[model samples]
Target chain A: MEIEIERNLVMPGDVVPCPTGSMPGYGTYQNEVGEIVSNVMGYPAMYNRLVCVNSLRGCYIGETGNVVIGRISQVGNKRWKVDIGASQEAALQLSSIDLPTGEHRIRSEEDQLHMREYFNHNDLLSAEVQSKSQEGKAINLQTRSSKFGKLKNGMLVVVSPNLVARMRQHFCQLNNEVDIIFGRNGWIWVYYNNTNELEVPLIRRQQIVRISCLLKLMNKALVMISPEKIQQVFERTSDIELEDLLAESTLERIKDIDAVE
Target chain B: MTEEILFYGFRQDGRRPGELRQIKIKLGVVDNSSGSALFQIGHTSVLAFIHGPKQTKHEKESGHIHCYFNTAYFSSSGERRKFSKGDKKSNEFEANVRTMFESVVLMENNPHSDIDIHVLVLADDGSVECAAINAITLSLIHAGVPLKDFLVSCSSGFYSGMPLIDLTYSESTSFQVISEYRVAVLGKSLQIAYLNYDDIGGHKLTPEVVREITAMAIEGCKQVHFIMKQELQNACSN
Candidate 1:
């Protein structure tokens, strides 16, 4: 049988019980006295033999195989520098990306010359972390899949990356005909489900706005976000006006709702 | 000698010789920065903002920490004094603060990144550098930056055959005090990170006197660490 432990908030230097043979994980270190201690401000959890603390808030740290949405800040000679809200800009090298032709062939020098034609500065796109550089100084990104490409006709909302839990699918479409791409790096894109339509219907627009407001509220309250919680918040606030959802009283009510859960 | 700062074995603020001033801390006060904190130690107040662990334009550097310390004209009680953009005193203070944090913050975690700390003095009564260190610690915690331990600092002054902890500006500058020292301690191990002393009126301190003063300052630092821990826990809960 596995022993269960309650989540408790911990600060730096707080001693944590590591038991006899337990191992310390991230956000924790072993002291000279053989006691496990936390190195950051967060909640402590015990997973079998491993104990680690989940940081409450902080800048996003990217890892390989994660899908992230970022803006192109610079176009280098053969790579485009993308800001994925991490410490370092991820590099989308010319060799990594699939050309517009979608052909798997050797790249010519001419292809490197026209790297700008593929992605311009300030353009937003979704990509996957391919690998880390040899020195671990920079991240390498790839955009070869159909889903990973330039984001168009969408509104971006940024939040703390910690709030976004890893999920099987970061893309979701609500029943109200609003599509959302929850970037692992804390950037969320909301748009109408019907991309072919030039003008989004009033109801779809209102739903998108409602989702945006919900995201903002969760961020402000510093609550862990999930698809179920977002849906519940959206449904609960359906009676209230979209603009009024941001009112202080409504925000307070939402906080109470979250606490009860 | 007529106006004695120590009256009936208590200081002018009615604190004991080894007592510290009231300390208050608030976290995440600023929205734009990655992390921010407002810290107050008695009349002295410091607002700290931390940005990044972000990419630096220049390459080849593992990680960089930059700090800027600024004092407002109206922070002091006396006549307002203007400071030029390149004030030497403020520049030196900023450099000292930056070096202190570079040792405390775990720069090895984020290689090739930059962490910038901006500290603004809203009020100056005394011990501004100590207050700045406390504020920076809170802001770094708020930003979720990894660190070996919290760095708590306190100042002590030897005067009238007694050691005073957490001295105010008036007490430090007063002719009654002979030597003053500021000490920063790592919270977990209680190891001294930085220490500096100055003779206020050319009154040098002996080895025994220096030891006594340092002990008092370390005690003050422990008290400060207690308060910081409580404040950080509160911030985490809410």
Candidate 2:
């Protein structure tokens, strides 16, 4: 878009070149003299009367109801501390998760003892941010939804959080071969669609690996990833061998692809 | 007033009293880290990076910062010597860096987070502290950390009855240059974030000398800021 070309770039602490009357918005703060200043390195754009800085890169800060994928780092008393690519570990309380039978029951001491059976250390899982503590220190996440739970037999591809654009649906099924979850926290998971199979089929596994590699390439080039962009890339690189796609020469070519188009 | 310190109004290295050395910088050098920068001024090279806003042992109201500053064995201009972390001078410099950035960084924005800072002085001609500060500031910007303004620094020395800006290793350690001032200022605001005065020869601390040297150092900071701004713009364009 022409508008993107005009977006004024600002580094941390730079004064936004906006009008004096504009209100400070996300990634920006008003100084004592009342001028809007950027708090991060990025372009400053106006959302109505509020001037906000669209940061190009930073740690993930999840809001309420946002779906995120994280690794369980610590199994504590009745809670699992998840490293969700945020500044702090997100808390997955025992009460926030549903049992396998989908029954809502009060947590007994037995459940606390069996917490490891549910989610152990270093286990990756998907959950929704439920709420935050008053100080915003403790991030509470819930895995009550049917699709939100432990992830196994999958490949995880991590990109910068900013590269994944917010979409109406983050989950996509590609050609009935693989399932992709574009976690808002930049953790992309490509797993087999068939849950019953303990081992992934060779074809599906190849597709999963290819998809993850493409995602990494897009992220390295600072391109925003969306379902449409993924389809285009799959079409473009279909002929190249999967191992050769990540070569330095191919990466250079891919970086300049937009210009050729 | 030593004749050898400055030969006919030009220093040994052939730089004017007001001139700074050539600076080269590259951002995001350490891809694994959240943010990293390699900053070189003259022969002084420092690599600075930050990791976290991640897990911490204890919780706090705002982001907690930890700084690690070290110098390589071959960093010094003279005979190579290991500048271990326990060295008094390096320890003091680390504390000064952390305290200076505490106010500049908007820590409250990332409450209950831990920010780790690591800086290694690969080569030290002079003004290693100033170089470290500038490197950290650039990497912080690369990481998109919140800050009131860019924290830039410069070292100035009072010698030969004149103020010398951006001192080199020989100029800084010369017996004739009795006192040196290292100042870090906030970009645009022109406020001093850090001021370090070293009296190597037991020189008396005078108000006039302080004012003059700090003024020269602040001017140096502005020049440093100009160069850093250009680097940032180039990174964005790419």
| Best model number under DockQ | 1
Q: Give the alpha carbon lDDT tens digit for every residue of A1-261 in model 2.
A: 112323767887788887656788778999998898898888877766778888877889787888889999999999998989888889999999989778888999989999999999999998998998876657899999889999977899999998776898888888767788888899998888675887888888888899999988887777678887878778878888988988766566567545211
Q: How does candidate 2 fare on TM-score?
A: 0.92
Question: lDDT by residue for model 2 over B150-210, one digit each (tens)?
Answer: 9999999887677889888877777778556899999988998888877666777578877
Question: Model 1 — interface RMS deviation?
Answer: 1.5
Q: Candidate 2, clashing residue pairs?
A: none
DockQ score of each predicted structure, in the order shown: 0.70, 0.68
Full-model lDDT, candidate 1: 0.83
Distance from true location, Cα of B224 in model 1, Å: 0.5
Tell me the spans in candidate 2 whose CA falls farther than 4 Å from its real position. Answer: A1-6, A133-137, A201-206, A257-261, B1-3, B60-62, B199-206
Candidate RMSDs in order: 2.8, 2.9
lDDT of 1 by residue, A43-149 (tens): 77778898887777777767788888999999988889999988888889888888888998877899988888889999999899888876564788999887788
